[model samples]
Target: MTKILAVRDLHLAMRTGEKLVPVLRGINLNLPQGEVHGLVGESGAGKTMLGRVILDILPPNAVVTAGHVDCATTGSQIKSGGRIFSNRGRSGISLIPQDPMTSLNPVKKIGKQMVEILQLAHTGPPRALQERAEALLAEVRIKKPKEVLKQYPHHLSGGMRQRVLIAMAFSSEPGIIIADEPTTALDVSVQRRVLRLIRDLQKERNTTILFITHDLGVVAKLCDKVSLMHSGMILEQGLVSEVFHSPSHPYTRSLLNAIPRYDQPREKLAPVAEDLQSQLIDEARKYDQQRQV
Candidate 1:
C-alpha cells in the first residue's frame, strides 16, 4: 500500500511563558492510502494535538522538539520538521473538526462559504460552483442541498452542519483528512448517521483519514487500524480487531476493561485502576527524562 502520511518519532512541547511542558513523546504513526486509522484516547491524551500538528495548525507557543510529519500528494510533498508555514491548507490535507456548530462560520451564508472553499482548489464559474457545492452536500446525504446553501450555519441542525463540513473537507480532493471526534457533540442517533456518511464518503473518495476519538466502539465500527494514545504516548497500535481482542499494553488493556459491553453486563463501570494509571505516567515521565539526557 502507498503511504499517504507518516509521523515519525515526533515530540512536541508547549511554551507557557517561562515553562516548557512536554506533550507528544516520540509518536510513530503511518496512514496508508484509503484507510481510516483511529487515534483512540481519553481527553488530554494529545490525539487532537497530533491531528493539529499534521494540519500545521499548532499554537504559536508550540515547539517541535523533534520529529517530522511527511505527507504525499499527487503533485506535491509537504514535510514539516515541527510545523508548516504556508497557506496550503486547501491544497493539501483538510480537517473535519469536532463541533459542527462552532466549526462553520456563524456569519457567513452556507453557499458563500461553500463557494469560497470550492474556489480554493477549483476554478469555475458561479453556476459551476453552485452545482459542485450542491453535489458535494448531496454526496454526504444532505437533502435539499440547494436550500441548505442559502441558510446560515446556526439555522441548520448539528448533524447537518457536520455533513456540510464533511462536504467541504472532500471539496479539495485531499489525500488525507483529520476527523477530530466529528460526532462528539451530536446525539447518538444523529452520530450514527454522521459516522455512516463518513465511512461511505471515505470509500467513495479513497481518502486516508486519521479518526481521533476516545470511543472504542466507534473505532471498531469505522477504523481499519487503531492506535491507543495515553498521556501523549501511543501505548499500542495494530489492526482494530487485534488491538480490541488482544491488547498488548497495560494501558490498552485497562482501556478495554473500562468499556461497558452490552454482552458482558457489569455491576458498575470498572474504571482503569489508579495504580495502573500511575505506573504508566511514571514510565512516560521516565522516557521524557531520558530523552532530555
Candidate 2:
C-alpha cells in the first residue's frame, strides 16, 4: 500500500525557561492509504504531540529539532522549520479534537461553524454552503441536521457535538484525519456509536486516519495497524492482530495486561509494573544523553 503520510526520524522539543526539553525522539511513522492506524500510548507519551506535528499546529514553544513529514497526497515534504501546505483551501489533513466542548465555539451556531468549514473547500453562495453543511451532518447520521445546525454547541449532547465535529472533519473530504482521542469524553455507548460512525465514514470516503488513543480495546476494534508508543518513542508497530496477540515489547505486554479482560473476570487487573516503567525511563534518559553528546 502507498503511504499517505510519513514521518522520518522526527524529534521535537519544548522550551521551558532556557533549556529545551525533548518531547519526541527519533520517531518514524507511516500511514498507508485508506487505513486507520492507531497511535496508542498513555497520556504525555507524545502521541498527541506527534499528531500536532503532522497537522503543523505545534505550540509556540515547541521546536522540531530534526526530521520531516511527507504527505504523498499533497506531494509536499515539510522539513523541521517549514510549513505544510494543504490540498485545497483547507488542509488535506484535518483534526477531530479530544474535547468537543472546547473544540466548538460556544458562541457560534452549528450552522455558522459548518458553513465556515465548507467555505474553505469551495466558493459558493450561503444557501449552497448551508445545503452542503446539512448534507455533511446527515452523512454523519445526525438526525434533523437542519435543526441541529441552528443550535449552539451547548444545545446538543456530547455525542451529538462529537458527531458535528466528525461532520466538519469530512466536510472538506480530507485525505487524512488526526483523531486525537476523539471519543475520550463520551460515554461507553456513545463511544461505540462514534467509533462505528468514524469507520463508516472512512470506508465510504477511503480516508486515512491517525487515531491517537490510550485505549487498546478501541485500537483493536478500529485500527488496521497499531503503534505502541512510550516516552516519545515507538516501541513497536505492526498489524493490529499481530501486535495484540504477540506483543514483542515489554511495555506493550504491560499495557495489554493492564486492561480489564471480560474473560478473566475473576483475575485482578495488572497495573504496568513500576520496574518496567523505571527501565523505560532510564532508556529514554540514555537516548537523550546520547543525542546531547
Candidate 3:
C-alpha cells in the first residue's frame, strides 16, 4: 500500500516551568493511501498531542524533539520537523479538531468559513465551491445544506457542529483527514450517526483517516488498523480484527476488558495493573532515549 502519511521515530515534549515534560515517545505511524487508522489511549496518553504533531499544530512551548510528518502531496512530500513551520494554508492534510467551537469562528457564518477554506484551497469556481460545500454537508448526512450554511456556530447542535467540521475538512478534498475525538461530546445516538457518516464519507472519498478516540467500540466500527497507545508509547499495533480478537500487549487486553460486555453485568472499569503501569512508564523512557528526545 502507498503511504499517504509517514511518521518515523516521532518525539514531542512541552516546556513547563523550566522542565520539559515528555509527551509522545518515538511514535512511528503509517497511514496508507486509503485506510482508517485509529489511535486509542487514555485522556492524557498523548493522543491529542500526537494529532497536533501530525497536523503540525503543537502548542507554543511544545517542540517536536525529533520527527517528521511527511505527507505525499501532489507529486512530492510536504514535511515539517521540530513542529517548525506554520501550516495554515497547506493542503492534502486537514485536521477536524476535537471541538468545532474552538476550530470555528463564532463571528463567521458556517458558509463563510467553508467558502474561505475552499477559496484558500483554490478549488473550483464560486458556484462550484458552494455546490461542493453543500455536497460536503450532504455527505455527512446533514439534511438541509442551504439552511446550515446560513447558521452560526452557536446555533447548531454539538453533533451538527461536529458534522460541519467534518464537511469543512473534506471541502478541500484532502488526501488525509485527522479527526481528534470526533464524537467526544455527542449523545450516543448522535455519536453513532456521526460515526456512520464518517465511515460512509471515507469510503466515498477513499480518504485516509487518522481517527483518535478513547472508545474501543467506536474504533471497532471505524478503523482498519488499530494502534493501542498508553502513557505516550504504542503498546500494540496491528489490524483491528487481529488486535481486538487477540491483543498481544497487556495494555491492549486491559482496554478490551474495560469495554462493557453484554454477556455479563456491567462492572466498573478495571484499572491497569500496577506492574503494567510501571512497565509502560519504563518503556516510555526507553523510547524517549532511543529517539533522543
Candidate 4:
C-alpha cells in the first residue's frame, strides 16, 4: 500500500497564563493508502487534539511546537500557521467533527449546506452540483433525498444530522478522512448504523481513515490497526489482532482488562494501578527523545 499521510514527531501545546500545557507529545503516525487506523484514548488524552492538528485547526491559544506533517504527493512539511500546502494531494483531507448538532449551521437547509460545501470543492456546472449533493445524501442512506434536502438541520434527528455530516465529508471525495468520535452523539442502535455506514463507505471508496474513539468495542469492529493513547502519548500501537490478543503496554493491558466481559458477571473490572502513572511519564520522556533523533 502507498503511504498517504505521515506525521513525524508531531507535538502540540497550549500556552495558558504562565504555564505551557502540552497536549500532544512527540506523536508519530503513518496512514497508507486505503487503510483504516483507529486512535483510542479517554478524555484529555489529546485524541481530539491530534485530529485537529492533522486538519490544521488547532485552538487559538495552541501551537504546533515541534515536528512536521508531510502530505504524500507534495512532500512538503506543513507547520502550524504555515502555508506550505495546497489542495493538490489526492482527494483532499476532510474531517467529521465530534458533534453533529453544533457542526451544522442552524439556519441553513441541509441540502443548501451540502450544496455549498460541494460547490466550494468542485468547479463545475450548477446542474451537476445539485445531482452530486443528492447522490451523496443517498450514499449516506438518507431516505427521500429531495424531502430531506428541504429540511433544516434542526428538523432532522441526531442520527440523520450525523449522516448529513458524513455525507458532507465525503462530498469532497477525500483521500484521507479523520472522523473524531463519529458515533458518540447517537443512541446505541443509531451508533451501530452510523458506524456501519462509515465502514462501508470507506471500503467502497478505498479511503484512508483515521478513526478516533475511546471505545474499545468500536475499534475492534471497524479498525484494521490500532494506536492506544493515554495522557497525550501513544502508549502502544500495532496490528489490531496483536494489540487485542497480546497487548504489550501496561496501559493497554489495563484498558482491555477494564472492558466488561459477558462470561464473568460477578467479576469486577481491574483498576489501572497507580504505579502505571510513572511508567507513562517515563514513556513520554522516551517519546520526546525519539522526537529529537
lDDT of 1 at 214: 89
Per-residue alpha-carbon lDDT of model 4 for 90-143, expressed as tens digits? 248888878898999999988789888887778888678888888999999999
**lDDT string, candidate 3, 1-293, tens digits:** 78888888777779999987898777899888889999999888999988877676667888777666677743333233423333543577788877766778999999888888888777578888787788778878889999999889999988889999988888778888889998887889988988998888889889999999999999999999999888787889999999999999878898788787778766665766789878888877786567555
Which structure among the candidates has the greatest lDDT?
2
Q: Write the per-residue lDDT of candidate 1 for residues 1-293, one digit (tens) a residue.
A: 99988889888889998987889998999989999999998888899999978887788888778877778753332343424445664467899989998999899999999999888878889899999999998898888999999999999999999999999998888898999999999999999999998998899889999999988999999999999988889989899999989889988888888889788878656898899888878988999889879
lDDT of 2 by residue, 120-225 (tens): 7779899999999999899999999999999999999999999999998988888999999999999999999999999999998899999999999999999999
Error of 3 at 106 (Å): 1.4
Q: Any idea how many clashes model 4 has? A: 0
TM-score of each: 0.95, 0.97, 0.90, 0.92
Indicate the worst ten consecutive residues by lDDT in candidate 1: 74-83
Order of the predicted models by TM-score, top scorer first: 2, 1, 4, 3
Clashes of each: 0, 0, 0, 0
Q: After superposition, how far is residue 235 of candidate 1 from its true place, in Å?
A: 0.4
Candidate 2 TM-score, C-alpha based: 0.97
TM-score, structure 1 vs. true: 0.95
Name the candidate, 2 or 3, with the larger lDDT value: 2
Candidate 1 residue spans exceeding 4 A from truth: 74-86
